[model samples]
Target: MHDDMKNTTPDSHKKKRIVIGVSALLVAILAAGGAVAIYQHSASAQLAEAKSTCAQAADRLRVAQNKYSALINGDEYKSAVAVTDKQVEDGRVVTTLAKDSGDETPTMVACNVEDKTALERNTGLIDKNTTWYETHAKTIDADVKNVVKARDAKTLKDTQTALGRKITDAKKLYDASKDKVKDDKTRDALKKQMDAAGKLKDGKDVKKIKDAQAGLEKAMKTVNDSVKAKQDADKKAAEEKARQEAEAQAAAAAAQAQAQQQYVAPQQSYTPTYTVPQQSYTPAYTAPAAPQQSAPQYSAPAAPAQPATPSTPSTGGNTGSGPISGGHGCGSLCTSAPTDTYVR
Candidate 1:
């Protein structure tokens, strides 16, 4: 019986050793599985935390990008273009505030992606944009302020130049209107306005300069109207004087012509008018019965006394007709009247 017990002891020891080895193998497998499960849980938590942080950053970035775009595309930015010259004069420059300062551009992503690599990349882009906008926000606002200042400066300068020209022109008009206006008051008003215009150069205010220009133009209009009125009156008076002088000249000419006609008539009717007709009548009367027209024509100056002289020359005591003698032919119509009456 002792020898049999000794033979089974080795087999028992071997069996116990095999059982301990199997238990150790099972414990190792269970520990490995627990480690893997813990690792997966920790990794998932990390990814969720990263996603939350990235999404919050994305929200901030979106707000920043909206602000940037509004500033760059706003009316202030557009108005800056018109004030280029003024900006240069004032030593102000406007440039791009940010590379992403454009239309409503959102962030790269909202961090809603599941892939780790994608989340990292999009988060980086959003962070970069947000940082850029934050860094230049003040500078962008400053640029807008500068543009406004430049616009005001340009307006002031242009107004000054235009108003200065008007002042100069008004002064010229005032000078010209010195002694030509109908009333001295009109020139006085122009002078007052011109004097006020000179003060415009000293002031920087646009409203003051514009007001001066308006006043000067109004005064100039008054002066011009007054001068025109005076000129018209002078012209009308001159025309009236000229018309009166012309009428007087015409009347004098008519009177002179009438006097000339009266004097000429008196000269024409002196004594020759009656004497000439009688001379012609005497010659014609004796020409019908006797051929003594030549003797009558020659004796026409003494025709009134020729009849008695010819009758006395006849030898007969009663004389019916005159004798035809070579010395005195056709005695009644002889060339000369007898000096004595029929000498014995």
Candidate 2:
């Protein structure tokens, strides 16, 4: 009985060893199968995530492309877009590799991050430019409208030149007529107007230029009127002076003709008359007694003396009347007589 027990115990020990070896083998197989299943699930999830990441990145790229299209086509912005396009292409290559290989590499992740960052930067630039343009749109439109108006109406330069010419002509006329202007106040007023016109500038407003032109024209007209009035006045004054001088000359001529009508001369021819007195004296018979006693009584008997006769004075005339007187015994025989003679 002791020998049979020993042999049975050895066999039982051998069976326990075999059973333990089989259980260990089955456990190892189950653990390996579970590990494979876990690995496959994890791999599928990573590929799905990679595909999602790639799709999101592609959407972002499409959005960036749309933004780039909307931005202003400038040299600087286009160059920046070109650089971003290269990054997007790199990201696409990484995404395709990740999707096909069902693997996510650090390199692919980095490419996606870089692509997104570049798209964000490009979009920011586009938004900045859009905001700036939008803010100043009204101001730019106003400027453009003004420029167009100026161009249509005779450009600002041409308008300025025409205005300058008008001013120059007005100045010349003013200078020519200033000396003839008689009124100081009017001349000064016109001068002030001209100065204002001269100072006109081609500013932004068209109304101001038109106003200046009108003012200059009015001033020129005023100057011309003043000059014409002065000339007329001078002409009238000259005519008046000439008429006065002619009247004075005619009066002097008439006075000289009236002084030749009064003259006088001396006369030479005269006759004179004279008168004699009406008295006579005579002697008696003294001559008869002297002859009777001639020889005997010649010495005794002397003849009586005769009486004296009066004489008459002659008058200073062509004919004279007077009485003649005689001496001794011829007093009575003398008679008064008148004398006549021609005087030349």
Candidate 3:
């Protein structure tokens, strides 16, 4: 039993030494693993930080690049091609940096920051220029529109003046023509048309003026035609009156000749006859009557013989030797007197 106990004790001491060595090796490995885990965790954090920084830079560059593209495409900034191209180059450099490994070098970071700053500056300039161009374009457009409106107004004014002159002249012509027209209806119609044309005064309505001008021209034509017709009628009336007067004169002459033929002077002759006159006697025979003896009867003394006068013919048949007058139907030897004979 004593010799067995001594061998067990040596075996137990060897086993204890083995167990201690194994425990020491396990502790060393665990310590080494913990150090490796801590290093990996630190590396992951650094990678995440680098990625976040690169992403931020990429975002900035993208925003700037978008701004530059928009400006270059826009109407206001299309002319700024040279400046926009430089900005595009800067954005390309930033894009390259962002696409590289997350472990960004100091030089790359610096380059990206510089490129981003340059892009921001270029984009700002483009924005400013675009804004200025937009404002300027609006101003120019407004000015052009105003100028066109002014020119149109001037043209309208000139046209109105010319139209006024034409209307005045037309009115003068119409007045003259209307005066010449003798027809009441035609003259009144012409006046009405002229009045309508007169309503086309100077105004803003061009259509009204043109319509009035047409009316005026039509009225002028009507007046002229009326005047011509009236003139022709007057000429015809004058000719007819002259013909009537000539006919009247010819009829008067023919009537005079007929009256002269119907009223021929009657031929008349006058003859005178002599008659002896008896004279009465009484005074010288008174004494002889006293004696009463049968004396010779005293006859009345015969009248002394008178000389006969020649009868003259009367030119007007008014003269007559008889006491009675105005006798007609006398013979050629008898004297004829005229009663009342009117010569036509």
Candidate 4:
């Protein structure tokens, strides 16, 4: 039994050695396979990124063309060309990098070739668009300024006609550039330029000229209405002043006639009047008559008796009758007596 175990052990050890060598060879083959798989995967990812970047660069070139067309129509061409040049440079870099890398599949190789060819063609198209836009922009600027400066209606109208001619020429040059571009990115860019030019031709663009025409028409109508209203007011005022003067003249004439009728002449005259007061009657008084005067008679008283005397002697003469006297007494007596006695 010991001898048989020893004889099989050497052959088994040889088989074991073969199995270990085969396992080591399998591990090394697996590691190599993994490394190859990782390298292929990394390379494929970079190629895809390169293609996507190249495509974006193509889109930028188209945008630069559209901006250039608008600038030409609006008289801004210098800035437009600068933008296009920068986009073209970026696209060329991406194309060169993609062409040199590993691409195992036939389809990947074809895609890479096609992308490089497209980039070379785009370079010429971009230059053409830039050159045309700049030339047209200069002409448009001068034409628009001349139209605004014209002297009269006839001259201004003539200037506008010339501007229309320049716009048509620019539109032709823009169309020729569009035909050279083949890709979707280039075609889309050309379409935008066509649309902007169409707006200018139709007179639909927002511009200073259109606004100025509308303002002038409104001002002329206002001036005409104001002139007519002022003439009517002046005529009415003159008529009112003439009527007031006529009424004042008639009133002055009537007052003068009434004053003339009140005049009179002057004179002086005199008249007299007599007046007496009345009296009542009163009675007069009378005195009574005096008595008459008469004469008076007177009576005497009685006397007493006396004695007788005796005789004297006697004489003798004549005695006649008587007798004798006495004689003596006794004796004589006797003698006388005797003679007387005898005569008797």
Candidate 5:
């Protein structure tokens, strides 16, 4: 019985130990699960915060870019300085925090911030020049039109002045990166564009303003020459007609004189036949005074009828149709000696 009791006691102790070990393992597993849960929640919350900050930075960059567009396009906009301030303010804190976190992503965030700063700076410079170009382009276009229209020497001169100024300004803007741009190809392209614009704006270039002016002058000369020629022809014709009329008048007078001479004035009745001594002596009466020679009338040689030169009209009377001829006063002048009309 003692042996059996000893064996039973050992079995009971073994069972108790087994129950204690199972309980301790269960407790350890539950503790480990709780720790993992807390860690996951904390990590998710930090990720959310970081994402929100990044989003704010991105939003600021977009807003700054929009403002830049406004400035470049010449719309009323926030001052450039104000836009820069806002961009930096929004991005600085996020960048600082990202750097402090010592995470691998901080380098990327830093680079993004730097890029944004550069964007703002470049756009600000470009915007100023773009605004200038916009205003100057309009002025130049209008001035060129005026120069072409009136062929006004003064307007042409002013256009040259304005274009020169614009070219200089554009050159300065484009030359900024000449030494600094890393890409040689891009730099050369920029320079070429600037040079082209400058050359086109040059007043001395035959293809530019000078050419248009020359064309206008040539057009005017042609018109003037045509008008003068027409006038001269008309005058010659008028003089010839006058001469013919004068000759006709002289001829008519001569004929009338001859006719009068042919008529023998009847001898006064002094010799009248001694027919009827009682009959009163009646003198044959000559036709009352022959009609006085009236001055010959002449039709003005029809204005050297200018051959009608068809021409396209100009919006402004001063500018003639394209450099084609008949550019001047060759229109029909009915009896009026001269009239100003634009012909081309």
Candidate 6:
């Protein structure tokens, strides 16, 4: 029994050791294969992640390019041109941040390259380009802001100057028109509008200033209308006065003409009237003279009928149509010679 026990234990122990050794070798081989697979998967994943990141950066750069394109079309570009000889200077802030010397465009690195080192290098370049785009955008944005601010300030100043001039003109018009306006209220309203415009002169709100200008102009219109109405009324009154004076003068002239005509005396022709005077004479008888010169018995013609004394002219007597011949002063009226019928 002792011999059988020693022989049987040796074989079994040696087989057992061999089997354990084989199992350990198989486990080691399996572990080595799993480690290789894991390493390969990790490497591929890293490359894919890098590609994705690089593509995203490229996309971001495209977006930036679009934004920059739009930005340059804005007013900042115009101001840059105007201030810098019609083009952006190379040394300017935004211009300096443009594409690098080797880069054809401002675009970032692409993800097409598969080498890890190249991908990493491209990633760095993408980051740099991103910074450049951001900086350029920011610089241009600031320039735009400053330009717009300056332009607005200038516009405000010009508007204020114009408004001030308008206010002055309005004031002058008010001074001249205050008393002549038909209504006191219109002139007062104009003054109020001018004052309001003056208050708004320092403001930056263009709309409000323009509104004030409109108000002032409207108020001026009212004042002007009132003044024109008064002027028209005064002109009409003056014309009426002139017409009245002319009519009065004409009437006076007509009255003077009528009085002159009425006061004129009628011319009259005078007719001479003669009145006969009756006289009685006493007869003187003389003794006949015995001795006389022989042939001429000429007695002095009876002392010609003594000339009839002139009597006062009769105002009521009618003038005879025919002329009368009388003893005295009958030469012009008598057609026959005197007859000597009785001698003294």
- Model 4 C-alpha lDDT per residue in residues 1-344, reported as the tens digit of each score: 98977778677989999999999999999999999999989766766655565555445555554654464445332322223223332343323323321222111111233343454444344444444444444443443333322222333444344435544544453354343332334434334533443444334223433333333223322333333344455566666666666666666666666555443111111111111111111111111111111111011101101111225544655334333355223244234443333323
Name the candidate that leads on lDDT: 1
Residue-level lDDT of model 3, residues 81-178, one tens digit each, is: 22221233233332332233122212122223324445454445444444444444444334334434444555567656666776777668766764
Task: Give per-residue CA lDDT, model 6, range 1-344, as digits (tens).
Answer: 99977778777989989999999999999899999999999999989888877888778777777776677766666664344312222234333333221134455467789877788789878878877776676776676655455555666777788889889989999899857989999988988999899999999898888889889889989889999999999999999999999999999999999987766532121111111111111121122423342222243233333423336654654355223344355452232322222222
List the global CA lDDT of all models: 0.72, 0.52, 0.54, 0.41, 0.48, 0.69
lDDT for 185 in candidate 3 is 68
Candidate 4, residue 1: lDDT? 91
Tell me how far the alpha carbon of residue 182 in candidate 1 is from the true structure, in angstroms, after superposition.
3.3
Candidate order by decreasing lDDT: 1, 6, 3, 2, 5, 4
Q: Provide the lowest-lDDT 10-residue window in model 5.
A: 289-298
Q: Candidate 1's C-alpha lDDT?
A: 0.72
Residue 277: error of model 5 in Å?
Answer: 39
Better of 1 and 4 by lDDT: 1
| Whole-model lDDT, model 2 | 0.52
lDDT score, candidate 3, position 110: 23
Distance from true location, Cα of 326 in model 2, Å? 34
Model 2 misplacement above 4 A: 1-155, 260-344
What's model 5's lDDT at 108?
Answer: 20
Q: Where's the lowest-lDDT run of ten residues in candidate 3?
A: 335-344
Candidate 5 local accuracy as lDDT?
0.48
Task: For candidate 3, give the lDDT of residue 277.
Answer: 21
Deviating ranges (above 4 Å) for candidate 3: 1-118, 179-190, 225-344
Our tally of clashes for model 2 stands at 0
What are the per-residue Cα lDDT tens digits for candidate 1 across 1-344?
88977787787989989999998989999899989999989888878877877888888887887887787678976676445543444543444322223324334556878866777777788898798776565566776676677667767787778877877887787778777889889888878887888878557887888888888888888889999999999999999999999999999999999999999998889779888989999987846636434544544545444555553454455454543334444555342343222111
lDDT of 3 at 244: 100
Per-candidate TM vs. native? 0.58, 0.33, 0.32, 0.25, 0.26, 0.51
